[model samples]
Target: MPVTEIESESQFTELTKNDATKLIVLYFHTPWAQPCQTMNQIFKTVADSKASDNSISFLSINADELSEISELFEVSAVPYIILIRNSVILKELSGADPKEFINSLNQFSSSSSTSTSHNGPTPLATATATKPQTTSQPEEESEDAVQERLKKLTTAAPIMLFMKGSPSSPQCGFSRQLVAILREHQVRFGFFDILKDDSVRQGLKKFSDWPTFPQLYVNGEFQGGLDIVKESIEEDDQFFEKALQAAA
Candidate 1:
């Protein structure tokens, strides 16, 4: 399906509520944000690629214009994306990372296709019989496992930034400033939103012994928050380059 532009709250409701079987990919953005501009192209590309998939729908809404919709989703940042199926939110991602965005869409497409195949051409009785077994699976994660996951995530990329939101759209002022600094220095980095995962958020405070967010990490080692980053940049012009090199 082609990408659709959401003009009003009613339009958004019409698009999402009318089709319970479609997967709605809602993109909340603003024209003023440079990161949003970058993400806009990526979003369109993903939509175009998935145009043949009748089960998926793409929508772009200006956060500034559609304040009601933004507020409903608590979208305080631009370039935020929410994946919905049957009016239920499956996942929410905040950022302008093309690779991650595409990967997510691909995963969803595969999973949704698989689900449809299983559900399609099935007798009502068989479908009902299998539904209960699927719903019985556990959904809990252990504390030790979460810690281990956090450890791996910090070093998932060479330059990792654990912030309140994404590098493109930051939820907090500190995170916004840190993103600006990183961009100003022309640094290529990967980010994880602490706000999205409570386990990572709370576990990190103890893991790195850093209570505050917008924390920078290079090659798995903890760097300080926004204030320390500013001071480091002031003291050394090549702060980012040197830090990355040391990590390497």
Candidate 2:
């Protein structure tokens, strides 16, 4: 299959949801990351080599350009690859290890072929299964459940910024300043609005041991709030890049 560059969120959602028989390989990246550029070539090579295989599809998505999709998949780092079938994530790989990535793909392909040969291919389903199915929908999450979700949300992007609103339209002055600083430094980040989810807002305070909004997380670790971010930037000129590299 040809490598498809996902230009929009709707297109990405459509492709992932509609294709159940084919293993959808989603490559999440950003143009700024040099490692991502290198991985792009590797990903394309793999896609071309497996072109004859009808059970696989390749897609590349710029994480910054499609923040919503990145957040949906909880993409924490660049050069991230995720394999999904029937809208269910089968595997997720981070960083730019071409050898490991190719091995993973080969293993998945082989397993899929074996499964299909034995059981036959299943028909594609329309609904996406982002979360595990339950017998009945719950009205609210437990404390522990909320904590777990907060942890996941914080690591949803390489540079996760939990704020009152989005980077474009901050709902508070602190969040506005933080967004401005990030933009000034040309930081590619993902954000969550605490106001939108009361559970996350309250839970993250205890989870990270930090009681504040506009919190920032690097990799899967909590970095701190806006003030600490500013201090780090002032202390290290390449703070953002260094953090991402260290995470990668």
Candidate 3:
């Protein structure tokens, strides 16, 4: 079958619950994200190849449009894919890495075929799943390297927010409120979901000496959390504007 665009939550439930479907490939994306443009074609290409196979189904879901489904999978980023089998999450792929998506689909789809005749589908093995082919151990990144990465991430945009979830789907109350504030101010900013990366989540705490999340940064400088942001706005109506001007 061709790739299906899910329009409603009820439709999503009905399609996923189909008894004939042994494998469900879910593509969660938003129109604004540029990476989704590339992954969308990749998803269609692969889905078309297996169009004759009734056991596998591909679904295209807009994260913003289908917020409930995106929330169901805890999807915080666009161009994300989730593989489901027998009501169980088999594997999840993030980002727009075409090779990774294709290889993973092939690996799990073949496994699903074999496992169907036996027991039910099992979750992807976390340990050996993405293990490197080399026999030698891999070297860990140096402290300086990690710091450098954090620096880059902080300045990824003029206004950066390191929060628990995406701006559209905030995982925590503080993050949700912060997003509301930014929107209220009509401020355009970029955000990083710290929940997805433990390294950044933990490293950022030390880097900025801030223990809590929902951290905001202006020009790569630590700007406090939600409370501080509110206070800054209270003190100066043009807080965001001033910060951006300073960066310029």
Best by lDDT: 3
Q: What C-alpha lDDT do the candidate models reach, one value each?
A: 0.73, 0.74, 0.77
Error of 1 at 109 (Å): 26
> For model 3, which pairs clash?
1-51
In model 2, the runs with Cα more than 4 Å from the true position are 113-248
Task: Please give, for residues 1-248, the per-residue lDDT of candidate 3 as tens digits.
Answer: 48999988779879988764488889999899999998888899999999987778899999976654664565678899887777777677889998988887888777754333223223221111211111121256567876987898888777888888666588899999998898788776667777766767888999989999899998888889999999999999999999888877
Q: What is the C-alpha lDDT profile of model 1 across 104-220, one tens digit per residue?
A: 777775665323211211112111111100011124767787788777888877777788755445689999899788767766566776776677788899899989998988888
For 98-212, candidate 2 gives per-residue lDDT tens digits of: 9888887877777754232122212112111222111222468898888777667766667778888555446799998987887688666767777766777788889889998
List of clashing residue pairs for candidate 1: none
**If the candidates were sorted by their lDDT against the true structure, best first, what order would they fall in?**
3, 2, 1
- lDDT, residue 175, model 1: 91
Give all TM-scores, in the order shown. Answer: 0.50, 0.50, 0.50
What is the alpha-carbon lDDT for the whole of candidate 2?
0.74
Instruction: Identify the runs in model 3 with alpha carbons over 4 angstroms from their true place.
Output: 4-59, 62-140
Q: In model 1, how large is the Cα lDDT of residue 239?
A: 88
